[model samples]
Target: MNPGLHPSKVTAQFEPLIAAFPDWHWEIRNLTIEGDYLALHLRVTGTHRGTFQGVEPTGCRVTTSQFTLYHLVDGKFADVWDLVDTNSVIEQIEQGKAVL
Candidate 1:
């Protein structure tokens, strides 16, 4: 796990992500938490106001879905994984399907 992610794991990912984003955030839609497993379905929306993927700023609005899962251990988070609709986002960017 990246220590930089989340401050003490107390929903603290927002801090680092905000620092990196400085533009937008992950808009959550559906979240499920049971036992040591955490599941989340959300959308990552933002403008390329900052450097991302070695690409310069485009100032375009981007929105993409993300599915994430986290594993908890000893009460604190232990492991996590996530999947995003990369092709959809890429097509949107390349084909101007969403213009963002």
Candidate 2:
């Protein structure tokens, strides 16, 4: 998890991504719950339709993986950590694969 990031700011951080990939979809590949912790493995798919991270739209369909964990406290999320395969997404965009 990024030290400078707080969970409350997550939505703001993702707003640009949502705009860039308006049709982005998330699929849960795996999920686990144990005690006060929950974990997820996810597959994300989308087409680059708008500017993102200073990269111009390439119209490339991209697939990436994400892993996330959350700590629950008294039935509410108290902390969250996540990792995304951003390098893969960038490589796919740079490859300029035609959208299917």
What are the models' TM-scores? 0.66, 0.85
Clashing pairs in 2: none
In terms of lDDT, the best-performing candidate is 2
lDDT of 2 by residue, 1-100 (tens): 2233356587887888888888889999999999989999999999999987778899999999999998887677777899988888778777877322
Name the top TM-score candidate: 2
What is the lDDT, from 0 to 100, of the residue 58 in candidate 1?
51
Q: What is the per-residue lDDT of model 1 for residues 1-100, given as tens digits with 9 covering 90 to 100?
A: 5433354665575554344347767888999999979899998876545545444555556688899998887676667887877666555444434543
Clashing residue pairs, candidate 1? none
**What is the Å distance of residue 17 in model 1 from its true position?**
7.0
